[model samples]
Target: MTAETHAVRRGSARSHTVPTATGGGKRRDIQGLRALAVGLVVVFHLLPSLVPGGYIGVDVFFVISGFLITAHLVRELESTGRVRITEFWARRVRRLLPASLLVLAVCVVLTFTVMPAITRPQNFTEIAFASGYVLNWNLAASAVDYLNATNPESLVQHYWSLSVEEQFYLVWPILLTVAVFIAARSRMRAPSTRPLSASVTTRRGVLAALLLVFILSLAFSIYETARSQPSAYFITTTRAWEFALGGLVALVPGLRLSEALRAALSWIALGAIVACAFLFGPGTAFPGSIALIPVIATAILILVGDSRAAFSPQRLAHVAPVQSVGDLSYSIYLWHWPLIVVVAANVSAWPSWVRIPLILVVTYVLAVVTERFVERPFRKPRGAFRRRSVTFGTMAASIGVIVTVTVLATVGIQNAVDQRQDDLQEQLSGGGSSSSECIGAQAVYNDCADPFAYTDLVDPAFAQEDGPWAWFDSELAATACSSATVGSWVERSCAFDGASDDDPQVLLIGDSHADHIASPLQRIAEDRGWALRVETRQACNPFRVAAESDDENAARCASWGADVIAQTVADPDIDVVIVSTRGDSGVWEANAATAFRDLEAAGKSVVVVSDTPNVDGRQVSNGDLITGPACVLAAGSVDDACSWDDERRDTWVEDTAAAEGVPVLDLRSLVCPDGVCHAIVGGLIAFSDENHLSGSYALSLAGWFDRELTPIIDGASARG
Candidate 1:
């Protein structure tokens, strides 16, 4: 989960540097800054312990890009009083699209060939987003979605930073053009003898506008960072302030500073940035008010002006190795991530010492070759290629090719998935389900000749994607009510109709863990002549365990829990209540015990279901951190593929239920047979991803649910 948010583009070698207020050739210090930022990001991804806050390197890149691009655009705006949006876009396309599109194309090929098949659908989906320069928004949405909880980072996830860069390339130029328009109007209205010339008016207007963007975006960044850090981290709105700060530096007039002072300030700012890299970590809430520390320091470093004083930061930046790395930072960033991910997947046993240097060497070589062949040729191309229409056309075609490649690859993968579904279905019809000797729990629990005999199910490539889906609605989920309707009691609550008023009224309530059981419970209701209503919320236990946190989400969950508890108790038609949750803390257990007592006092029958076999979260006896989903994906249902959880889950369930003298529906035998659990049970992918019970596997256990729940339903019917 390292966020390796690499910055995308760099100028070609002929004139790769930006000028200060005082015009100059390539700035070795700026190049050094690129080296520092990329080095931090690369090291963070490779050696996170050494540089946890290295992710802030992306913010540094953001500022560098904003400053460089805004400087280039404003020079034109001040000279001409108008900005050419298409011409600006065409230049960006030439500098970036060739290298980026080539990498994306290569990624498409690797996803089809080298990457794990289970990851292709997601990988290709993100590739499409990256192709459109919208991967940041896609990532922001995914970060907040509970359904995507186990969706691992894709090969091109690092493109999110580049996506933000592309969006800025589009918007910033337009904003500058508008600033020029405002300046032109003001100039026309000014007196003929006015001292403020056209260039001064335009610069003043742009400075004012950029300053507004800085303030508004920084305030929004702070506000949103506190509200939703995950989403805040990737969105353009929250990050625009970083770029605005850089733009302000680009436009602001420079000071006449002594060499010693410039060197002192540059080195200090540079050290502060590197120090912040060490200070931050995965747990840190990013790019909020805290981000201002590094962002402001970067602007100050730029503001002080570039210098090559022997002890200054620029001297270190200009060193042969640093300058070389900075020259290829964009290409290195692109190639290194996919290579590292692929190597880790294929050779996980290799230690970091071996993997890190090997990846960096290979990455540097690739970067050198890509910059030489792909990047240089396309940038500032000759006659026909330099035409704005041709550059635009080439960009469109490159995007089309990537989209086409991804679509074709995805279709082929889907076809294989479809064939897998057919094969599993054929097995089921050929007595996989009827005998109860294979598929799901029976294969393990029953006295079958070979417990793993049937082994008939969709391939892990397809099955790992399975998840609880009862929250979706055609009708009974209520109008405009679905998984998105969480945060309140009145929404996302579904009611399955009963045949008659006298039918036993049952309510299944809790969080996502409760949702996994919906498949079988609905079958139980239909078969046993009972009415069922499934009321589940994301991460919100029926007991409101989040009451301790002051977060808005926690408050919403707390309010929802209180509302459901009272409403379920007040509704006389409700006869039985079933509760299950992941039970994040001991507070949930105490609250569950209290809730059980309340239900019993209301004359309602209650059943407590134990949490699932949790090898995914629990520590192993040998202290190995192997995950069940990962084991299943690699080893299938083979011997020793089965693993044991810490064995505390069953005890917790019993202790919570025993407090109120309620019956605990202990289904450990079905999930973890005799203290051993298989990644795939009864030939079905037992978990959606490591933990959540897959809907398909849950449905396969319908027979067991019927046998066990019949008594509870009969008693509830008698009570009703």
Candidate 2:
């Protein structure tokens, strides 16, 4: 999911209830919770291996936000008989936007100056989305996208939680308003003799609505997490339950316990929160059942009421240091992530002990400065900044400026990318004059005609200017010809290689790896007058024993694979079944062997393509995952600087093909020459990310592909 940067509630009084401009007191215990939540997140970011579940801190913030915001709204409704939506929104703007926009502006400047050109476009887009409080939807879409899923995290990735909170702020007041109206109408319709007042009726109605929302959202969260974990994590609907749980605590009455009982519950809640932060991890199916640990714990702590007992957890929370950190929590959350990302990007190997302290000191300094100069000034009611219109106008202008600058920067970067693509294309076309002599399996590995070569430059451009790497999606991904989401299967077929109703049918099957090669294969199919049907899924291997976890995806992939095999066997016109995947290890080889054997028994010829070498050197910088090629390019180093020298001896495909007596195609020689896998080969960026091939690189292999495939297809046709 996403991280949220929550502002500390500003007030002078000391009480458990949320503070309002009118009168409610401060909750030092709540501030301590804020300190604890941010502390977990900061530590998690600094040393994730040490605190694997620190991400749960974000959920804690969500619960705190829901409880506090709901309490404030309910208080307003009780006092005024109606919620002031605009005034509430104005206060939120004053409290949150100034600090948030400052961070965005600084991040944008850093993106253009220090971040890689290839990553700027995406970051800029995210900046725009974050500014508009819709980053969650953008992240949700990217999360489910098979190609985008592998992308390194964004600098603004943490903004999704803030976006979620803002969305709640926008809608919750409107819902309360409606509830108030219903309550008022009900009270009016009741006899004048009725005992219940309008406020009581309204409160009951609001409580009922909140309860319904909490139930529905919690159920959706459970279902969606099981079905599509990635989407579930970022989507507002799945996360609304956590917020609603907090709201229920605020709206529901008679929840306060005796001081002794409260203290006990408080300690239990604190233990639960701490235990979750230590125990939960990435592999944990989050915000589902596991998320209840942190969410419920946070809710319980809020409901227990802050106690002054010597042994009370609230007393510990009320300590000066914790309250101080809580005071700086918002600005610290805003500053820390980008700083970490920038530092990591530049010096990824920095030890955590050193990095953590450095990040903390710098983030604290910046946060203190921002909070004093930016946050407090606008928030105080003693100056010109106190004007509601001034605060609202300033917030609006700051957002507009961020959007404008991000757009201009993105457009400029895209233009540069387009120009570089054109130049690369020209060089590639001219270099291909010797294609006849150099375009084959043997010539591909040596100093043959390098279409992507740049003679004048000292280093190859590691980042693909225009290819799969440039945009994570390839031709197949763009066309939606394969399954890109989890637990969902959509069999998409398209005619390729000028194949018509009478042409021989060729079926391509497997996962995303199969889809990556579809471009070159499409050209081959068109040249040979064959119809190519591509059947693939995000992580589905199409193996007899599915390699994926035994979840919904595994079941769907198993069923999908069986249906595809049956159709291939049943269709007499289907001449060959081509299988390829990213790797050959695990259960894939076994599954591939079974599929090949089944096709052979059905009198269908099978072609098994060996998996490509995966170069693993990408590092997380400033939140984004910078690829080896991009890193090398940014450093102005030769391709060897990022090249992988070790041999990938996984010949599972060849071994399985031998066992099954099927034809095999190995593209290793073409992609990795002289037993070395380079991030950039010839003049083109070799890989889309670490594992998948760039569309341009894959397309460049068309000549060699046709050379090897023609014999297999011809022999199959001859046999037929």
Candidate 3:
């Protein structure tokens, strides 16, 4: 649906100087570069797990943007003898803002229509922050989060990069202006007959300085990419170098290289980019050595492709489809992501087959409308109003929308679907709490007033400041804080006393989630009268162990998990090795299978506990049911909300345990009943927030483990 809006006036005077497109190439080369970068990003986003290296497309875009923007700025400075900052910004606003604001507006509307009231408030706040151009900061504060789920305002997470570039333009122009002022002043004061080479030398010097900064920043970015991929991926500081590198490339006056070198370089650059694309899928090292390929490839196209080149890529880039995409690239980039995210969030299912075409069609339509209407009018010659006032009015309109959205989000948050929490007041008011009597009672301790039995269930407080069951245990709040504070570790202070040299053995090793399970392990060890030995770290899943990023802590955790397993197996005195940890690539699951194999070969009894369910790693309990009536309405169904899915139960938890040749305990079924999962079982809350079981609930589950583990222990001796 396309809407036509009226013209608005700019603040004051508008710079009338129009930009002169420089450096003739068959427009194809530029278009091809744009196509390649955009296609890579789209594919990567559709299936990041499949294309780990595809994210390099953003870097590619940065380089292209840097080159184009710098080239334009340099040309203007040289021709006009002055760069008009206002006009530059006006052009930027016309080109970028209209489409962006439209996307934000759509996201806000979709969020209201589709997202659950419980989560909608947070999403709205995120969207407002994103609109205000502080999304990077907002996301950085959250850190390492992949905003792919049903977030209220997450439709536009990808816009953070655009925000970074916008921010760059905001500051870069002033710096360029300073450089221009200096150069012009120097030229005027110097002898008029000075050789033209002097101008070339001055440009070269400035370009050289920019190049040094770019190189140095790139080095830092590479280091950080390995150390903290998430930070390196998102933060602007680490990324500025790519843009600067492109700007540096633009500064070179004459690229008169031999055709052989050009072709060789082009082929090499193309090979680098293609290689990175195929081999460097998602989760691969990035902004590191891997990034150089695409960045350099983009540079090759800009530098080597010219009118004389026999097989210039410019023709390819300039094709109708490519140019169309390139023309609306800004708008396509802005609108496509949010549309895809919102559709995914609302639909609750995503597959490449469906999503790929959907994103393309939606992006094309949005981009075309935004370009034809919102953008062209403000920039083109118009008699109704001055461009500067229109720009000002647009800015004011955006801020006004921002204010309105912010207020609505606040009100929505304040009035987030309220439940009859009074029922909760009565349950806690009574003696202790009622035991959960649901069908899955064995798997769920909530039937026995076990607070942690439903740790995976959503709670009411989720919509409130404190969340559901805030009264049951303040530790729910404390635990989250504690989890964050533990930091990433190579080793941790044991939660329980260590087993003596002569005592029957207890082996503990796993990831951060496993560490969280330490509370339960300590109780089990005490009840069984065994020494507890634990080896675990934050984010170090024992299943797939690999040292990928530059985070020192991840490295330490990887080494520790392997060493701990080897040492436990070597000890003949150790009777039982309990290898429990969160599984999967996220927590270094690569090493888990080997760790289990070694234990089995050593003839040590290994018990691998399955991982609990979590949303974005945050523990969610059924407590969300208390504040809203959605669960109440869907109370009788065997659908997802009422029943645990196979992914959480069989795949992540059960599959890992079974693969390692250990007894797999499916706890989810025990916690949910009648196809309904409740965060609070019986009258007691199960999970503190999402996954971590409350201390009391964990203690209560000890007997269930005793029933299961006792049989395993009894059978081990007889079999041996």
Candidate 4:
């Protein structure tokens, strides 16, 4: 979510939210606030170090919306006895849909043509959600799902805030109508003291409702923020309180503070927003207790600005710089994020000073054109948009454009994936190598010519989808088994194929390296009649002492590691402990050896798999940046495409385990058979994203893995 500053609210002369004009001129105070909010967001996106907490600019807009919309609704309830919900919705469509859809159309062009081909499908999915104005819920689900937690940022990531605002627009007017009904029903029983007394009662009822919303939403925000900050950051429930705070301000517009107090409070509120912009960063837990700083400060500033008297000295918001920016705030907010994202990813060689200014100039220029051409044309009720049917139709048509583009783009992406799959199938059949071994790493052992060669690689999207995290999630989140999970939230079976009490009890446990192989190995366990129990944490090393570290993740790893180690050694039914880790030197080696020695002493058969190659490093040659499957996608089936020469980390776990009387299963030779490694070998893509093997590639190596582990499993089974 990004800057979504609304235009100044035009209220009746006696309205609580009436804009304050300066010296008989139109009010620009709200425009100034919009300018400040959008400026903070743009600066944060461009040069985050300068304004770490500038993300709160979104909260500023939320308060502004709540205040203005609530004021307008309450005014209608007083004067006309009801809100024009249809007109309000039509107006919202006119104001928002035009520029928002324009940006999304541009995003569609970028995703299909200019962006990485491997991730176009994923990008299109996000685009579809953005078009639907539910991108925030999509993002929240992704945030909660550990499988999707590491997804790359999309072009429309900032649209999540707009989605929240759209939802509020949809629900707030209906709620105000409810308050009207409440007032009417109450008046039927008790007599009125004055004319339009029902309106007064309705306002009070609305005020009470807003107060309850503010309190409950704020409390839920704090609770959910602590429980899961990533999900809470985007979900609307965590943000309702900010809007309620603004509504409450609108309800109490006549709290007559002195002119001196208004001036002081406005300046102080502005200062507070600035402080939040500078002080808060990504690490700060948000939309919870911390978000109150900017939300409350923004409400106070709006309250004070609207309350200022005619003779009062012009406030900061009435100034020219702020007013100009606020005038084009919506357009600027829409354009800046996509520009920053694209520029940073593609033109990283440029220094921050050079890039930031260039980005700002381009964004401002685009905003100027959009404000004049796109935004202005839609704001006026003319031609097709004049009819309410046509107004809503225009919204449907705008969304339809995004949907059509996404569909066409996704079809192209799917065709490319299908072509790649077909080409790989042909290559294997055309070859004279062992037909059974013409898959992934097994091709190397079976002496297939140019085993690392390929004419087509597994699509990067498929490679990512090939990770075994889903089964881990099933085991961790589902009811079928008691497998280890991140927070111990649920118990699930980590088995690939089903097993029972009569099967050999084999345990595969480690960090993510073990996980990469778990899917294929699950099949291996089933074929061998072994009860495979798999558990892997992302960064946790399988060590006894849990080498000291300051990172909170490391602390979690330590705790998880300790629990896993104790469980394995204590459980006599566990036939073998298959340990894998990305081992390092120093205390890490010492910890690994100690853990292995203890496992051996407990009479548990132990086998250590070597660490995989260092496939995670970035390839930044000249000005080109190739990541994940980009190298393969660029090279396209060349003999050396997507190959790496690094080989240092291959045996860290193997060597340490061997020293502690643990049998070693070194697969470096299989992965990098000729002292060079390729991401795709024998038509199979290996590493998912530089860290772990694709489940497809891992499953393809079942034969060799089974051979190495059978003797270990057989020994343990005999003992049991």
TM-score for each predicted model, relative to the true structure: 0.91, 0.88, 0.66, 0.81
Best by lDDT: 1
Q: List the residue pairs that clash in candidate 1.
A: 439-682, 440-682
lDDT per residue (tens digit) for residues 1-720 in model 2: 111222233222332332221234566777888899999999998889888999888888888788777777777887888888988888788888889998998989888787755567678899999999899999888887666666665678789989998999989899888987887787778787757865687678778778878889888888888887887888888888788788777765544245566667788989999999888888878778778888998988776656666667888877888888888898989899998888765666677778778889999999999989988876654675667787778778889999999999777766776676555444434544664333222236445655334323222233433344233225744563433343543344444533566666678887767777877787677778877778776566666464456667768777787787778888887777888765543456766677777787887788888888766444323234345456445435443445556477666666878787887787776666667665555555667666777766676666677887887776776776
lDDT by residue (1-720, candidate 1, tens digit) is 011111212333222232354353566667777888899999998888999999999999899888888887788887777888899898788888888888888888888889877788889999999999999999988887766745766889999999999999999999988877887787788787757877788888888889889899999998888787888999999999899889888877645556666667777888889889999887887878899889988988777655544556666775799988888989988998888888866776677789888999999999999999988887758989989998888789889989888888778877876666555445533554455446666565555545543254535676656656632334644542344543222235667777788888989887778888886787667777788888888767667656455576677777788789888888888998888766653366676677788888897998878778665523321233434455565554464454554365435545778777998887666777666665667666677666677756676666677777788878877766
**Candidate 1 weakest lDDT stretch, 10 residues:** 1-10
Decide which is better by lDDT, 3 or 4: 4
lDDT of 3 by residue, 1-720 (tens): 011111211212321111123553334456567777777777777776676677777887888788778777776766665578888887777666766777787778877787554446566777786777767766655554322112233677787787778877786666676665666566667787655443454464456556766877788888878666655667777777888878877776554455556556666776677678778865676767667778878777666553234453344554678767766766777776776666654553455578678878877887789888877775554663357777857777885787587667767555442333344333333444332222122335434334233343334334223232223234523432232323323345352343444445566666655554555455566666656666665556555455465357555655666677777779775666665555554633335566666788887787866565442211222333222223312232222233233245325534655766666665545454443445444323444434444333343455566666666654554455
Off by over 4 Å in 3: 1-26, 47-52, 80-82, 116-122, 145-153, 179-205, 257-264, 306-310, 346-355, 381-390, 414-426, 432-551, 555-720
Poorest lDDT segment (10 consecutive residues) of candidate 3: 1-10
The deviation in Å at residue 334 for candidate 2 is: 0.6
Off by over 4 Å in 1: 1-22, 187-195, 415-437, 445-447, 452-458, 470-481, 485-491, 545-549, 616-627, 640-642, 649-654
How many backbone clashes can be found in candidate 2?
A: 6
User: Distance from true position, residue 23, model 3, in Å?
Assistant: 4.1
Stretch of 10 with least lDDT, candidate 4: 16-25
- Deviation from native of the Cα of residue 271 in model 4, angstroms: 2.1
Q: List the residue pairs that clash in candidate 4.
A: 475-492, 481-492, 481-493
Pick by TM-score: 1 or 2, better one: 1
